[model samples]
Target: MQKILGLFLFGIVLLTNIEAKDYEIKMLDMDKKGHTMVFDPPFLQIQPGDTITFIPTHKSHFAQSKVIPDGAEHFLSPLDQKTTFQLNQEGVYLYVCPPHQMMNMVGIIQVGKAVNMQEIRSALPKLERKAMTNKGRFLEYAKQIQE
Candidate 1:
């Protein structure tokens, strides 16, 4: 009976995770909005366990995690290559392109609720300071975080 119960529980866990989804983001040099060095659709809302593929639509862009929820894994993709990141933890995730960071090549991925919004918010000032061209752009994305 004990062994049977353990197997049943494990099966239920797998079933719960079956609904996870996948998403995509583009690393762009310039978008229709006339912005440079940015992620197309710079802000994304997703659920925990979702996966995101960062495609380099232009060049010299990689998805590098800047801030993540505590216990969440950090990811950094190769520059100018397609890389996929799995978001397993719940909270807000911030990413940037190292080569064009000064041009404000940044983005946000909010998983579930903004469970770690305060921590992500506290880091915005530094992100803003590090930006050379698009001042206040980081905070602008942060403001879009709901709850």
Candidate 2:
């Protein structure tokens, strides 16, 4: 009887885990040339009920939204150490760094779908455009993060 009860408890735990989804974002450091960039895990996709944890192993890093084409929801970590952003949408997200925009520090997030490499690649230019234009709103958002 004890063996049967243990098996049932294990089954419940497994089922609970399947229902919860989680993801991670690692902000990488500068290369030999001192260019800070966001290392691509290539693709990070999740369902609506999922979370994305942005872990910056160093200072001077945060995440922001791409406004023009994708109009992705934005979230930035204050200069206060580590931060996490839980995703609650069902659309594609394109993000970039403000200070290092010229260096092409970009990333993509696709929610409720399998990893699509081409889709992510296509969105890269939008991020570049926003970075180059130094658009008022976007840059302001970054400044807020630093503040």
Best model number under lDDT: 1
Return the lDDT, model 2, position 6. Answer: 100
User: What digit string (tens of lDDT, one per residue) describes model 1 on residues 1-147?
Assistant: 999999999998898788777788988878898887889888988998889999989987788899999999999999889988889899999988888888888999999888887788788888878888987778898778889
Residue-level error in angstroms, candidate 2, position 95: 0.8
> Each model's C-alpha lDDT?
0.87, 0.57
All predictions: root-mean-square deviation over Cα? 2.8, 9.1
Off by over 4 Å in 2: 1-18, 30-36, 40-42, 67-72, 114-124, 130-147
Tens digits of per-residue lDDT for model 2, 1-147: 999999999999998678767676667665444545643342465666577777776567776766322333577766524666766665656676566566566665666642333554465545556554323322222222211
| Candidate 2 minimal-lDDT segment of 10 residues | 138-147
What TM-score against the true fold does each predicted structure earn? 0.86, 0.59
Q: How much does candidate 1 score in TM-score?
A: 0.86
Task: In candidate 1, list every pair of residues with a backbone clash.
Answer: none
Residue 73 error, candidate 2, Å: 4.0
Candidate 2: residue 78 lDDT (0-100) = 63
Best by TM-score: 1
